[model samples]
Target: MVERVTATEETLQLLDKLKTIHGELMFHQSGGCCDGSSPMCYPRGEFRVGDSDIYLGDIGDTPFYMSKDQYEYWKHTQLIIDVVDGRGGMFSVEGPEGKRFLTRSRVFTEEERRELSIS
Candidate 1:
């Protein structure tokens, strides 16, 4: 009986993009500090998807559902939503468009490497 939670305009747009690429997405928080702390579209086991949850959308043309914990996390989010694309690429969200979910992970960005000077 689980249904997809309320999706904002921006969230829907992002979802559409993933659908086009036939990608899989996961949302998660590294449990860090800073506004919009959680990262979205995380590429790996960031959120831990399972087969027990009721999937609602298509990831890579495959529908997926969330675990109980995942649903809870989305229910209480305040800043952003974590997402992992079908291709296993991780990403985070921000701004008024995606400010409904609370972020938990440390902020992730392509710029992170530049800050850390990591290749």
Candidate 2:
């Protein structure tokens, strides 16, 4: 099956470091203004997932979610999580680490779209 979300090796390495320090982690992406458009990382169970949130799959053992409305606008693309040198969202766990999680994306191939349809 095609993954809706995946992370780069750099991102995975950072996540491992974060997990060692923060225990379990999770991610949420929203369509709200400012940092909300960026993915926010948090300690598991710290940020509640609402009924209207859509699970987009996991990256480095961390579950990724986005608001259903955001999903509607992003469904045709695959989310690629990467880490860049900078501060993350103010509320994200990685903010203090001087590295931020970045969301990159590409439109799914026709075959991938078909696979998703079949699923």
Residue 104, candidate 1: C-alpha displacement in angstroms? 10
List candidate 2 segments past 4 Å from native: 32-37
RMSD of each candidate?
Answer: 14.6, 2.7
lDDT of 1 by residue, 25-92 (tens): 54443344444433344433445655545343443332334445444444322233343223221243
Model 2 residue 17 CA deviation (Å) reads: 0.3
Give the C-alpha miss distance for residue 87 in model 2, angstroms: 1.2
> How big is the positional error of residue 10 in model 2, measured in Å on the Cα after superposition?
0.4
lDDT of 2 by residue, 35-65 (tens): 2246899999999999999999999999999
The 10-residue segment with the lowest total lDDT in model 2:
29-38
TM-score of each: 0.33, 0.92
Q: List the residue pairs that clash in candidate 2.
A: none
